[model samples]
Target: MGGLSSEENASSKSTSILLQIVEHSDGSVSRPFVPISAPSDDRPDATVLSKDVPLNPTHNTWLRIYRPSVLPLATKLPVVIYFHGGGFVVFSAASTFYHGLCEAMTGAISALVVSLEYRLAPEHRLPAAYEDAVETVLWIQSQARDPAAGEPWLVRHGDFSRCFLMGSSSGANMAYHAGLLATALELLPLQLLGLILHQPYFGGVERTPSEIRSEDDPILPLQANDTLWRLALPKGAERDHEFCNPVVAVPPELRHLPRCLVKGCEGDPLVDRQREFVRMLEREGASVVARVDQGGFHSVELLDPIRADSLFSEVRRFICNDL
Candidate 1:
């Protein structure tokens, strides 16, 4: 009654919005996933040069490359093939969050970064992104097998023999898959030195300790996680499908995968699955560096500067040590 009619105010308040992706008892209806594109080549560092180039014209698949402006003479740097996390539905390679992260990582590690822009799901679906991930590796292998076919940034200074696949969330799922393929296909003269997964995304139908406990936490919630699987997983695929939960069956042999560094958070609903994955890796005799942040929530590094610094510093240590 302060300035508006009581009936009008009541109607406005009642119609206020809630869930971004709504799921009814009968069927689910999700909002369209529109990505925010960051300015091209408008990165922070003056010395770091960045640009976007298409990998496949048919699918419009592309990647953003980042490198130092002034390289130390005769010094070959490690190559990092990075994939961004969005639950496989939202965000993109050109998003400002990944842009800043890649720039900082390139500067800190003194390495070449190639951020893959894989297709989002609920539109493209599971194996689509996985296929793109594999293709990116093949692209690198092609470049290494013949320098003329390589991207300028890589051909000039990247050390393909020491390449690493780094991803977070759903992208982590892709990184693990791509690593498995690298082992089987054998990209000669280009060795995959390591796999760095920041909060590796894996899930199952059965409730785990963290999943049962941490429902509806800020960054990743239980209901949201379910909806993501619904959208990300291929049509008719179950929660325990091999793509979502590798601990099940696909890729019967985990051998040939390089050492891995998996970062998880106790406060995250996904951490329990991450822990299980580490154990599976151990059983397979694969070397793993499990770094769990006490009381840390999911994707804290995406916003908090201090947390981002700590995450990147940990990543730097893993990469440098592997080299």
Candidate 2:
């Protein structure tokens, strides 16, 4: 809803300051609005159908679903509820990048993909994203209990028993929080079988080698990372609030977490922390599979088709793997 500020107006493509959402010299705020892509059934591998469905009219939360067209009769596919990554301050579920990603995921995994569009921060802030993520799981459970309240695609063809929660970058942060909450929350027929965290965004007061070295990376820089936390986290809250620096300590609830797959990019600043997360999960005795791309940068999978195919292949394998 916000437009470009004076500083952003002057230096958009070549911004000098660390801020992605700029605060102008005159004290006005400006953040770039993401372009939304229309749902289409024209993907290359499969004719993917998609539509937007509101979760809660009051909170302005909603989801976009993507599913393959050609399916055998009486067949119900596994479900993937995805959260798009934008540092929790930018990006949209309806963005073309996410649409393409969901299309690939749906085709590769043969699953129903529900991409969530939750409230962004600087306006709504930290726990808002966390709360909405948890509410999405709860919302699905509600629909399962009452068919009249559910969406047609889910009610007709979605298999709640095989549902998986997935997200990339900061959205992965949301997925982690939600997955932790799901440990205690009751969802009858809808079981959370796994979690897929790709290029998870996490930080701490002490800088790691990747963060110290990646000063001006094209996709995500240390300053930009700090700025996103400043804008998204609770006001005056430090980055170590279990949500941001998850690897610091393993909580008891982790024992109840479903099997998890963590994807990390070698060229990403956050890769170290992602590795640390895997280590923590391991120490906690959680069932986990971790992958590190040799040379890929953060979110390159969303841009490059070959990379996307490879990444989605891994995702499909993770989701379809028998425990």
Candidate 3:
């Protein structure tokens, strides 16, 4: 296996590894509530707050906040509104994977991180997750303005003027569209720092040469990618919805939208599509930095802490450079 070709190695490893990781977790902790750890000098301080703010009062949507601990007397830290991956159907704030990543991000960027637990599909479906994302942003803005909310980190540490939208995989798709909708509505008051898209899945198009080439990549197989997208998109709708696929849906006028840091895996099926997105963003006059890590698979950073730190280092540099 060590001497095998990249495609052969990936195909053999993807299923067994994914099954082992996802199956054993079952997403349940033994306690009803677990105390979050404080950020140390070595690790960013983080805490989880659960709130019942409604997305649609009728529909009754809410979100949980994963706020990184702030430096004492620190003012106006950057804010990262993050969405978790998991193909839009599995995983939640409870996952150790999410908790650790959010903490690391807080420490790396010195930003107040807001992780949205949006409703998933096929129960929620298509525009639902996107809508929730928009609402979450609006809610953050509202909370920031309210003095009665009394100086929470979002208001204290958050610099609404310097907000960064970030997401991994399916969450990246949501973040991309939410930014578009924000630009369209003229509701984006913050200085759009940049977008951090990690292994973004833009949906299966007519399979790019890379997709065909890496068909059996270890982390994300072709069939699994197709199945996740099918569940995420609208019933009978084309995969190229303006909300789903930024390459087609993104408008020419919105070209100067924001800076972008697109991270892709050489072994992942979505590598080509991510590269295409980076090209489109660059063409639109937006500053873009695209990095393709050799021999990496989809969300490999999340699965391995060492890799996650390397990825986070790049993200920190991007955020701090702008700050």
Which number leads on TM-score? 2
Per-model lDDT: 0.79, 0.82, 0.67
Better of 2 and 3 by lDDT: 2
Root-mean-square deviation of Cα positions for candidate 1 versus the true structure, in angstroms: 7.4
Off by over 4 Å in 3: 1-60, 186-189
Query: Using Cα atoms with residue i matched to residue i, what is each candidate's TM-score against the true structure?
Result: 0.87, 0.90, 0.79
By TM-score rank, best first, the candidates go 2, 1, 3
Stronger candidate by TM-score (2 vs 3): 2
Top-down lDDT ranking = 2, 1, 3
For model 2, the stretches where C-alpha displacement exceeds 4 angstroms are 1-19, 24-28, 41-46
lDDT of 2 by residue, 231-262 (tens): 88888888887879987667789999999999
Q: List per-candidate RMSD values in Å.
A: 7.4, 5.2, 6.5
**Global Cα lDDT for candidate 2:** 0.82
Query: What's the residue-level lDDT of 199 in candidate 2?
Result: 91
Q: List the residue pairs that clash in candidate 1.
A: none
Give per-residue CA lDDT, model 3, range 181-224, as digits (tens). Answer: 67765444456667888888785456676666544556666555
